[model samples]
Target: MPHKRRVYFISDRTGLTVEALGSSLITQFDIVEFQRITLPFIDTVDKAREALAEVNQAHIDTGQRPLVFSSIVDDAVRAEINKANGLVLDVFERFIVPLESELGQKSLHLLGKSHSAGNVKDYNHRIEAINYTLSHDDGVTHRALDEADIILVGVSRSGKTPTCLYMAMQFGIKAANYPLIPEDLEANRIPPSLLPHKAKVWGLSITPDRLHQIRKERRPDSTYAALDNCRYEVAAAEKLMRQTGIPFLDSTTKSIEEIATHMLHEAHLVRRVY
Candidate 1:
């Protein structure tokens, strides 16, 4: 049996960065199991000491040193956390020094810099894009298709809605998604509402088996969720996309992030947010 090590991600704000970095590093050591804990908003000395106590307790319980990944910017708080009976890896301590040296300047050591709302314009854009995506989901309305940066078209449950929302939230892209219904599939053509913005359209395809499984979870034993219906829908949708020369991608094996990123690259759309 593999020994499970305790892992902590402590941050001055939301511990997203530390968690992302820690998870990435931990995955490289496949032989070891990890029990993850996140301690966010540890900006004060008292909070830091509390976090240290938790880390020490984990170490005592496990009879092994826990791994601590900290992103605290305050020197005093960071020092307090370093006193824990575990291995402390501070992200800012490791990289900020090199960045300061390279830039020949001191770092601001600011908190909440990673996901700050300091850029009002960018923040507003992201909010607007998210609202737009929500309103336009599943071909609910084609009223504002002209304002969309990208339009995703695919058969039902082909991973379109999530991909659209991800692009909107992560990249500040105005994304709209439309489902290709059986009527449009039978006609072997694109939707009339999307025809005006055909250049902004991208298609997503998934294997019929995968689609069948997904639909079955929503409506088991129904004709809509039947394997044969999934096969026909996918085949017709793919054929229509091919006949129209629309660029498409398979969503079966790709994550929503990968799909949105590839769509951005293929469409040559610039991301408004990082």
Candidate 2:
């Protein structure tokens, strides 16, 4: 087996951009293992220096030259990073330099400017969608019943949380999820809270053996994570979804991006890319 090089993704703004670009970058190097460390909104020069020192320490400790993939927007901030010991790859510097040359104009760096803000209606729609998502997030399991644009129900570790978060983040969709508890299974009825929202309910199903393997890692030796239990919950939950006329997706072999995209397409929801 070939050894995987450790690559660190650093950002002094929202780490979302760094993560998104890094995922694309890693696809080009299929054999390399990636270790991600996100440093978001370290905007000041002092903070930038501290961040660079830390990166150098990590490179020395690991005895490996770490690849720094960054999107530090401020020129002074980026300058501090370039002084570090390891190899640094700056996305803005790489792209902007060539664009400046081609356009035959000096490129001015403006760090905090946003070009587009949608109309009032679109702005209100996003605000409402975000409010719904936050109010129905993972902690308040029951609120998912009332406010979701779509409710995804499944057995534990069937990828409920990640799918819901992705829908909210990628699209401006307010997504909620519920785990099919043992009591709900025994009753053989979809929870009453979800009945009124039947039209918007969605389901996710996973193979029992695969779910069992996933759960085992979390709470090993418990019957809750057993193969038999997973099979029963999955079968019952899926049946409930279908019987209630809820449309669903099998999340067994799909990546998080693929699953979110499929659901968005099926639901006719538009992705509000930032």
Candidate 3:
């Protein structure tokens, strides 16, 4: 059996950065199985002490010291967690000290500064992008389609909706997605409404086996979920996209984030939010 270990992401606020860092690092060691646990908002000495206890308890239970990735800003609170019976990696202590020396200045020790909510413009832009994406989903309406940074076209369950929403949420992109029904595939052409905005149009195609599996979950024992129908639809959709000069990606092996980021890069869409 692979070595089993516990990993903790400790932070002063949302713990997103800490989790991202720790998760990325642990992925390098595929031979071991890591059980991740996040303990966020550790801003006080009491909270830090509680966190330390949890880490210690994990060590006792697993007979292995947990890996702690922390970004606590409060010195007193950090001191409490420093006694954890694990390999504690301090995020701020590692980078901020070197950065301060290089710049010859003291760094801000404020809590949750990285995820500060003071940027009103960014918040507003994110909201607008989400709203726009929701309204334009599944070709609900063509209104303001010209404002979209990128548009994804694919057959049903080909992974269009989630990719568009991810782009809008993560990058503040006004993304819109449309589904290619049987009629469009039969005609062997792109949707008429999308032609006017072909410059920003992209496509997503999925493997027939994967598409069949996905559709079967949503609709069982139906033509839509049949392997033969899935194969036909995917082939026809790819053919239509190729004939219309639209670039597409095989979404079978890609995650939502990968699909969204790929579209953003290929389309050269400006990220409206940081």
Candidate 4:
């Protein structure tokens, strides 16, 4: 078994920034295994010391020093964290000074600034987008189809719903998705309702084997889950998308994040939320 190293993500606020940054770097070291824990809202010296104790305990237990990735803005709290018996990677200290020097100004060094809900307008936009996505899911309604920033057309379980949801939550884009049913596939055309907004439509297709596996997990032994049906649906859906000149992606191997980001990039859609 590979030895698992301990990693701590520490922050003064939600700890999301530190966790994301640390996790991204950790993923680069595929050969090494990591056990990560996040300690959020460590705003006081006492809390920082408490977190340091946890780090120290992990190091003692594992006979290896834990790597600490911290995003604490307060100097005193951050200083306390530095006393841990591990190598500390300070996220703010890593770039803030050089950024300040380049911009010829000092940083405000405020806590929770990275992801705070200070911008009520942007926050509201994200919430509204999420609501819109939920309502329009699975072609539930076409009343406000024009309001959608992007619409996804795909076979069932081809990864439309999650991709739409992620785009709404992360980028604040109002996404709507519709599944290609047997009628639409046999007709070899997108739904009539979707055709009106074809300019904003994107497609997601999966390989026959992948679609079969996914469907079998949902409704085993049914025709919907059968390999032969999955093959027919995939081929017909791809052909429909191609004939309509709607750009499509193979979602079999792509992560939801990758698909959403790729759609945003290809369509040149602006991100309303960061």
Candidate 5:
């Protein structure tokens, strides 16, 4: 096994940009393993310095040099992090220097403004409601599967978990997922647990080749993750879904947003929020 690499992303808030950059880097290195640590909302110089020190200690303890990806907006705060002893890639420093020269104007300050005071209360209320729903989420509750807003049934790795999470998180939907195991496949049946929920049931299908690639990344040696087995399972699962009169969405090419939106619209379910 190749030695794993640790990557840290420090940001004023959310760290979304740095996360995107880290994801892009991972795609370029097929066989390397990368671990990500996000230090969000490190707005002050002291906080930024502390984060850098933590990364430095981690590198020394592990004996592996980690990469630092950062999007610190404040130059004074960024200066504190530059003292670290690893490869550091600051998004603002890297882009701002070249961009300032290109644009011929000082870059505008862009940070610390997420939501306004007038909307913050409403936003917080909605966040609270969503968190409550997720904790009390009835999606996985047994004996109540029939009441699911959307019931997803498919073979493992057919994008069931992520789809369900997206539906729940994005729309406040109570989405449930049931995996179609080998026994279910061999018997040519949807699970008895989901039979009563057939009206609300929806299938998620993936291209076998894509499924193979996803599974191989997760578990490289298993026959269950091999291409031939993936093809067999996907085909059988699709046939069973069709025979059982369950409508399905192919998830191979669509983003999670698109898939969830299609299901909501097609099923006539009203979306509570984005």
Candidate 6:
């Protein structure tokens, strides 16, 4: 068994960047098991001291030095955190000096610049996109198809709703999703309402076994969840998408992030939020 180590992601803001970077790097070393903790909004010297105490305590408890990944921009706060009984990896200190040398200028050393609170316009755009996606879910309305950045067409539970919401919340993309119902599958044609916006339509397909497993959880012992029915619907949906020349992706193997990103890339949709 691999020895477990305590890990800390410390930042002056939400600590999202530190957590993401640390988690990604830690995953490369499969031999070590990591216990992760995030200390966000550690901008002040007092907060930094508190974080240091926690890190030290973890190291004492585990008898191993806790790995600290810090994105704290403040010099005083970063200095205090460095007093902890662990290896402190300061992201800004490590990169900013080199960047300053290359650019022949010093960095602003600002806090919360990456995901700042002052960006009201971008925040509002994300909220609007999320609202639009919620209201337009499952072909509930074709009234505003023209306003959608992209339209996702898929059979039920083929991972449409979550992908649309993720795109809206994360990228400020007005995503709309519609289900390919039994009638549509049987007809082997795209819905008439989607015909005008066919150019923006993307299809999501999944393996029958996976779809069957998902459906069974919602409607146990029903024909809707049967493996044979799932196979038929998927095949019909794929054929319809091919005949109409619409781009499609399999959702069985892709995460929600991957699905949303792939659709954005394929559809050439501009992200309003960074």
- Which regions of candidate 6 are displaced past 4 Å? 1-3
Which pairs clash in model 3? none
Candidate 5's residue-wise lDDT over 103-126, tens digit each? Answer: 999987578654333476556745
lDDT of each: 0.93, 0.77, 0.91, 0.92, 0.81, 0.91
- State candidate 3's TM-score: 0.96
lDDT of 4 by residue, 1-274 (tens): 6447999999898888789889999899998789999999999999998999999999888888899999888889999999999999998888888999999999998776754388888888989999999999999998899999999999999999999999999999999999999999999999999888999999999999999999999999999999999999999999999999999999989999899999999999997655
TM-scores, all models, native as reference: 0.95, 0.65, 0.96, 0.97, 0.54, 0.95
lDDT, candidate 1, 1-274, per-residue tens: 5447999999999898899999999999998889999999999999998899999999888888999999989999999999989899999899989999999999998777765478887788889999999999999998989999999999999999999999999998999999999999999998998999999999999999999999999999999999999999999999999999889999999989899999999999997654
Arranged by TM-score with the best first, the candidates are 4, 3, 1, 6, 2, 5
How many clashing pairs per prediction, in order?
Answer: 0, 1, 0, 0, 0, 0
RMSD of each: 1.6, 5.3, 1.6, 1.3, 7.8, 1.6
In model 5, the Cα lDDT at residue 268 comes to 95
lDDT score for candidate 6 against the true structure: 0.91
CA lDDT for candidate 4: 0.92
Off by over 4 Å in 1: 1-3
Lowest-lDDT window of 10 residues in candidate 5? 132-141
Candidate 1 has an lDDT of 0.93
The sequence of per-residue lDDT tens digits that candidate 2 reaches over residues 121-229 is 6567667776776667543657545656787777778887888877776677888776767777778776677778877777788999899999999999999899998
- C-alpha-based local distance difference test score of model 5: 0.81
lDDT, candidate 5, at 35: 78
Model 1 TM-score (2 dp): 0.95
Better of 1 and 3 by TM-score: 3
